[model samples]
Target: MKLLLDENLSWRMVNKLGVVFPEVVHVTSLNISQPASDISIWDFAKKNGYTIVSKDDDFEKIVLLRKAPPKLLFLKTYNLNTEKLVNLIIANNIKIKEFINSDENDIFEIFGE
Candidate 1:
């Protein structure tokens, strides 16, 4: 599954997460406007088949309101360094895969401890 990393996340994560999520990309790398709006990113992901990866709760609210074409992976944590954040995602790789593949669920949350 393709993943669109939100601007809140570091662009460097695109390379770090590439080991497992080969199709991952950060918003800055795209042609879209700098500091893209959540709606714009949502629309872009829907059009391009990218599942959004973000720490923002706005996406969850959007998904609840609009339903999903572009799935969401919500990172439910705060104050984590990029390395730890990357590790959190990497550690939950299998669950993420299952989440992407499942049709019953559109939002998968990964909590950091």
Candidate 2:
């Protein structure tokens, strides 16, 4: 599945994890205006077949309000360094993929180690 990293996430993470998530892209790289809003990102993801990877609770509310086409991966990892976050994702890659491929769920959260 394609991943659309939200504005809260660094675009560098895309380059760092490109091998694992080849289809990933970041909001900063999008053609849309810089500092795009959550709603605009959501709309973009929905239109582009991306599963959003974000830490925003606003997205959680959005998912609750309107289910998926753009799935949500909520990162609850608090205050982690970039390396730790990357490692955490690498470790949980399988579970993340499974969650994405699941038919019944639209949201998946990744908590820090």
Candidate 3:
């Protein structure tokens, strides 16, 4: 599945993660300017079928409160470092796939080691 990285993620992380996530795009990559509103981004993803990968808790609310698609990878980890985040994604990718396929919606929160 593809990952649409949020504005919170550095654009460099997309390149750095390489094959970990098949396709990862930052908001800037989409040519959207900075300070894009949460709802707008979510709306874009919903309309376009891009599952979100973000550090923001707002997506969780969107999932729980709004039940939007495709689902969300909510990085709650505090490290906020590139390598750490990449490792978490690599480790949890299988679970992520299950989330995308199963009937239930998911919230994947990475706790920093």
Candidate 4:
């Protein structure tokens, strides 16, 4: 599954995650206007078949109201650097993939253990 990473995440993650998630992209790369709104990102994800991966709970709220198609991965880990964040994702890769494939859930939350 492709990930449309939110602006909250470092754009550097795009390349770092590229090997594992080739289609992963950051909001900055999309040429979205500065301070892109959550709605706009949601629209882009809905149109592009990209799941929104973010630290923002707003997207989670959106998923709760809108239902599927633009799924969400909500990273709830605390005070992690970009590398640590990426590592966390790698560690939970299997769960993320399973969540993407499942039809029952729209939002997947990842927390540091």
Give the alpha-carbon lDDT of every model: 0.93, 0.87, 0.76, 0.90
Model 4 over residues 1-113: C-alpha lDDT tens digits?
Answer: 79999999999998888878889999988867768999999999999999899999999889999988899999998779999999998888889889988998899999974
Off by over 4 Å in 2: none
RMSD of each: 0.8, 1.0, 1.7, 1.1
lDDT of candidate 1 over 21-99, digit per residue (tens): 9999999888888889999999999999999999999999999999998899999878888999999999999999998
Give the total clashing residue pairs for model 1: 0
Query: Of the pair 3 and 4, which is ahead by lDDT?
Result: 4
Ordered from best to worst TM-score, the candidate numbers read 1, 2, 4, 3
Give per-residue CA lDDT, model 3, range 40-98, as digits (tens).
78887778777888888877887888885857888888765787888788888888777
Taking all chains together, each candidate's TM-score versus the true structure is 0.97, 0.95, 0.86, 0.94
Q: Which portions of model 1 show Cα errors greater than 4 Å?
A: none
Per-residue lDDT for 104 in model 2?
Answer: 85
Q: Which of candidates 1 and 2 reaches a greater lDDT?
A: 1
Which numbered prediction scores highest in TM-score against the true structure? 1
For model 4 the TM-score comes to: 0.94
Pairs in steric clash, model 4: none
Model 2 C-alpha lDDT per residue in residues 15-40, reported as the tens digit of each score = 77677988989899898877898889
